[model samples]
Target: MNIGTAATQTGLPVKTIRYYEEIGLVTPDRRANGYRDFSEACVEQLRLLAQARHLGFSLEECRRLLSLSADEGRASRDVRALAQQNLEAVREKIASLSALEAQLQRLIAQCHGDDAPDCAILDDLMGQRGN
Candidate 1:
């Protein structure tokens, strides 16, 4: 199959597939005409990459995961460790976002949102008012 068919199978964009190729992630064989020829196994790898990316794995992390996925003797503990690290990062981001949301809520409540030019949010952002 071609790149288009692989993209359709993986539900990924053609550009993303090209980028993956550029980054040495997926190496689809090139025909004599210099066009990419994706095989069934290559398409399966592309699907795996798409799922990994959807799960928030970075490209480098995805590379490692792919390597481990291909290694028949790989331990499951290695994959679990990576997932745990990602979960902790997600938790920290959620906490940070929660704090930001609280501050934004406070600022919005303080704002009059009327014709008057006295904006509480502006004052808070400019350090003119206490947080």
Candidate 2:
């Protein structure tokens, strides 16, 4: 198959596939006419990459995961550690976003959306709170 068929099979954009190729993620063979020729295994790898990206794995992480998947003698503990690390980072982001949401709610509650020129949101943004 070709790159288009591979993209369709993997649910990734053509540009994303090209970028993955550029970053040495998936190496599809090239024909004599310079067209990329994707094999069934290459398409399967692309699908795995798409799922990994959807699960919030970075490209570097995806590379490592792919390597582990290809390694028949690899231990499952390594994969578990990587997943745990990613989960921790996601938890931290959720906490940070929750705090931001609370702060924004407070600022919004303080703002009286009337004809008044003084805005609490603007004041908070300008570091002039409690003024």
Candidate 3:
């Protein structure tokens, strides 16, 4: 199959598939005319990559996970560790976003949202001490 068919099968854009190829993720062969020739294995790899990316795995992590998946002798401990690391990163992001949400709520609550020109949100944004 061609890149278009592979993209359709994997639910990834053509540009994304090309980028993955550039990043050494999936390596589809080239035809005599220089067109990319995607094999069944390549399409399967793309599908796995799509799922991994959807699950928030970075490209580097995907590469590592893909390697682990291909290795029949790979220990489950390594996969578990990687998943745990990603989960920790997600937790940190959630905490940071929650803090930001709380701060925004406070700022919004302070704003009167009336016809007056005075705006607490603007004051806070402009580094003013109080409004």
Candidate 4:
């Protein structure tokens, strides 16, 4: 099929398929006088890349995983380890965000939005704004 057809089959954009070719991810054939001629295997490879990317794998990581597609004894332990590390990072972010939310809520409560122009929130936000 053509490059456009391959893109449609793989659910990737035409530009993305072109970029994959440029990055040595997929190597489709060239027709006489030079048009990209994609094969079924290329479509499958693009689909695999899409799925890997959707699962948060970077391009280099996707390449590594693709290389393992041929390996019968592909050790998935490394993938699991990466996933665990990412989960821990996410949990840390949640904790940090929770603390930030608490601090913001306290500041908001301290801010008495009345006519008297003595703003505690502004003082906390800009330490230069003298209390």
Q: Which regions in candidate 1 have their CA more than 4 angstroms from the true location? A: none
Better of 3 and 4 by lDDT: 3
TM-score of each: 0.94, 0.95, 0.94, 0.63
Supply the global lDDT for candidate 2: 0.92
Clash pairs detected, candidate 3: none
| Candidate 2 structure, TM-score to reference | 0.95
Q: In candidate 2, residue 131 scores what lDDT?
A: 31
lDDT of 1 by residue, 26-112 (tens): 999999999999999889889989998898888998898889888999999999998888788789889999999999999999999
Better of 2 and 3 by TM-score: 2
Candidate of highest TM-score:
2
Point out the higher-scoring one by TM-score: 2 or 4: 2
How close to the true structure is residue 50 of candidate 3, measured as C-alpha lDDT? 97
Better of 2 and 4 by lDDT: 2
lDDT of 3 by residue, 7-82 (tens): 9998999999999999899899999999999999889899989998887889999999989988999999999998
Candidate 3 C-alpha error for residue 93, in Å:
0.8
lDDT of all predictions: 0.93, 0.92, 0.92, 0.81
Q: Report how far residue 129 has shifted in candidate 4, in Å.
A: 9.3
